[model samples]
Target: MKDDCPWFLGYSGGKDSSALLKLVIIALSELTSYHKEITVIYCDTGVENPVITDYVYQTFENLKSECLKLCLPIKYKIAVPKLDDRFFVKVIGRGYPTPTNIFRWCTDKMRINPVKQIIDVHPKATVLLGIRNGESKQRDRTISKHSKSEYYLSQSGSKRNQIFSPIINHSIKDIWSTLKFNNFPKSIDSQKLGELYKDAGSECPVYRELPGKSCGSSRFGCWTCTVVRKDKSISKMIENGYSQLTYLHEFRNWIAEFRDNTEYRCAQRRNGQIGLGPITLEGRKVILDKLLDVELKSGIALLQKEELIRIKELWQSDLKNPNYIEKTAHSRVVKVKTHPKPPI
Candidate 1:
């Protein structure tokens, strides 16, 4: 309240973020005066797990109304990746392979970059996160490295902005207790959240300034995540009665397998080198066809109309200038003469 800089709160609609949001709202309500503006931001990656996505959208609507009733100075914003950077646009549109641990490119483009774009505009802004000390060993180490004090930490890759984690020291038990007991907003349904977590596990971070585990490890992550060998989270959810996820789970498994088949990939790299490259145009079409089938079966809009338009445009461009080059393993490099140095 004493600070004049704006605050951005990262909310992932998971337990930790829910608890942090509840605490922040209660604290704000008790205060008689407001010194700075606070924007609660949620990154909607479009490929988020359907079950959690629905919960988050509903919660957002409810939170808005509830905040208005209490007359709290809170703003809500849903940040999304640019059209070109979206999952389907890159894969089906550009023939990029599904992310693997070695070539994982999804998180930065889809999740972190969108949020960072918002925060970078306000260099002095303070970000509020739901990070806790005991979440994981890697997470604990990150916290220790970046710790400025008990409650504050230095924002990664920034000199001015700072990270303020109110629930930095909260235990798993304490997190649930906070959500259950601090019922000020009423939008955060602890019971529903608990049920969601019954089959699910940890959540993906909305902002990835501090690296630890990848998003594919979480049930609340993208449905198309293929970094993990087995998407146990969605599989368990299906067993626990989320039958709608069956088609998505199947598609995810199929794509991971499809990505490994040599017949579908180019023999040359996109940069004109001799190596296994992106999926071929025919392979991309096959994947798209399967995805459309999944969308029909599951009654979910996996790809937007605009995304379809963009995909077609990219296909036309790729037809004109192919993404791969016809290079052989024994191809020799052409040496070029270097320019003469400028006289001193």
Candidate 2:
């Protein structure tokens, strides 16, 4: 008998991943003669909307029920990053500049790291990611390389990591059509989620420092992303009567303002000498005061408590360093009530 390799299906509560999960479930059911373990893993950043989290949990329950019905041995796991206030950690906690395309340190820390940790344990496994061709040019290049390469680089095949993206060939329309025809798993409210997407009408911001400016008109990301000049996600949420989201929206808006004020950034790099251009002295003071005010008024710790401790320790160290000096706070920038123009 041939050895059965384990399957690690990546679940991201998105439509593509959900569809991929359904297909995998169906395929595994038909292949009942084989004795293989399938583990569905969802890497949580602890920042997803409550609705998304609920959907993830409910989907697992439904999948488990299906597995039992089919008498299959399919297990599931959900992993979340340390409650490290990722956004709050660097910006408010350590006073790092808001993320930009050039400095997208958040994705790896919050999105990729937790999943990579799981993969490390399953050194020899076939990992399935729901990356579709229509997603982006980067994804296209990745898939093309995987198709042509001797080993799948994404799965780290050199370490016996096998990546299988069955839906890479499917189009967005095809995916939705399949879901619509098959009916959304009872776990998720297709109608409500569809409404949310329609209303949100924002793309996930891959770039943070200047979201719309650099990445385009997308906001499906951290509520506190300072990259976009204006946060459409917050605006859409508020418009949809999610009043609680307003605080997050306001906070993000404030953060964007801080990014424009360059002074808060380091004159010299994290090391001693200047790497990039210097952030003006005034900009630095503006960013620090604003960040401190946001912490005080919002009464929300930007990073996880432990991360905050680390950030504060770093701040203290920077204060004492001869190369870097802490400056006094400056006057705050008053937010204009009028809605600003969206990214062109």
Candidate 3:
């Protein structure tokens, strides 16, 4: 309350973030005078689990109405990646392989950078997160390494912006209690969240800093995530009655396998180096066809119209000069390790 600088709250529609938001709203309500404006930011990766995405959109609507009703100084924003950076545009248009642990490239483009762009406008803004200490051993290590105090952490590469985690010390049990018991706003439905948790697990962080977990590790993450060998959260959701996810689940599995298939990849890298290159033009066509089929079967708009236009533009440009570098002319060559083929 003392600092009057603008505050940006990162909300991932997860239990921890939900609990933290509840506390923030309650705190703001009790304040006699507002010192600063608070903006709740959510990064929609475009490929988020449909079930969780619906819930989050509805919750945002509810929060907007309720905050106005209570006369709280709060705003909401949904951040999204650029057209060229969207999942399908990269994978299908550019023939980029689906992300893997070693070559994981999706998180920054789809998640963090979108949110970071917002924060960058406010140089002195404080970013409030819902990170807790014991969520995982790696998380715990990260917290300890960057902690400035009980509630503050160092925002790497930024000396001006401050990072504050209100629930840094909150336990898993504490988070549940806060969500289940808090009655204000009435938008965060603890029961609904519980059901999601029962089927899907935790959520990926909306705005991760240095040393953070990649996307697809949570229920609220991208449905097209292939970083993990299998997306257990979506699988569980399908088994637990989310039959609509069947096609998406199958496509994710298929694409993960297809990404490693040598037949579908170019012989030269985009940088002109000799290595496992991007998906071949033929491979990209196959992917787009299959993705469209999945969209029709699942009744989900996986690719936006603008994204498709962008993809076509990219494809046309690539056709003009298919090779990034002429393999014979390049002096430096790197041998790419072949990956084991997925089960046929």
Candidate 4:
């Protein structure tokens, strides 16, 4: 590795990312402090599971503090989407329909773009990840396309970077076993993972198990993902005793279910393309209402203060659109509480 070339690790807080994190830490620990130009980053979509968000925050603190004690240059960073591009702003403010596989507009905004932007800042560097062959057939195929050279140049029109994966050939068992032999305090809760696996009952999901379906016994993707048919992984956590997250799961499911109801959407898209879109302003208020109620009941804020501020601004802006019809479409309110939020 080049002495000054920084390395960026993509962390998702799932098993694969956790393993990769440990591997990078171990590698950097072996090198002299002068050669340790490594940066580990997590792309936070803002709407991630509260448990996961909390875990990652604390874990980063721990890793940073430990590296400081060792006098190492390993740094931990978090990449977040721009405010207006955040998930809630796009959904409630702009009224984007819940993302489908065909319309996954959130991916680039919430995940990829932020990471790429980080890479672009370093002029040229190495990006590391935990992607492995046995994880999926498609992933394996993609990995095969790259050269076996120690490094592969990843570039864009404006910037160039390198990509490397030390654990490309590691199997599922190998990953777990390696961790067993070289564990640092685990980033995720082992007890919670065990509970999730037990809650999964008969079979366990592996890697990506189709949208809306649970991917594994203890997966940790964004809490707001509507792509999967069932966020079984998070649901399992709730079942196993993380009641605070239940309302989050409910809200996520509701958003997905609510997106397709023609009664709520505008007759045309923002571009007049005659397509499905976000619900009405009144409908959006209903979502906001439930979200607030959930926040009050769970004592965990689902929407950040900044997000609420943005949504309010968007609502006011929407009222000014040439298409705004206050009389018919904007007058509705939550006439009655839909469901009492569960006891905290």
TM-score of 4: 0.83
Model 1 vs. true fold: TM: 0.92
lDDT of 2 by residue, 172-272 (tens): 78866766666534444455446555544333321111122332133334555555567665577678776655655676676666665533444445465
Judged by lDDT relative to the true structure, which candidate is superior, 2 or 3? 3
What C-alpha RMSD separates each model from the true structure?
Answer: 7.3, 8.1, 5.9, 6.5
lDDT of candidate 2 at residue 45, scale 0 to 100? 61
lDDT of 4: 0.65
Clashes of each: 0, 15, 0, 8
Model 1: per-residue lDDT, tens digit, 1-344? Answer: 66789989988888888899999998998988889988999998989999989999999999999988988888999999999999999998887889998998898899888998898799889888888887779888887877775455656556567888888888999999998987677999999999888756677787654567776878778999998899988888899999999999999999999988767776678786767776766677889899999999999889999999998887666655634432223342212122122111
The lDDT for every candidate, in the order shown, is 0.82, 0.56, 0.82, 0.65
Candidate 1 stretches greater than 4 Å from native: 149-151, 326-344
Candidate 4 deviant stretches above 4 angstroms: 146-159, 183-218, 323-344
Model 3, 318: alpha-carbon shift in Å? 0.7
Residues 49-81, model 4: lDDT tens digits: 787677778878877777788776778878888
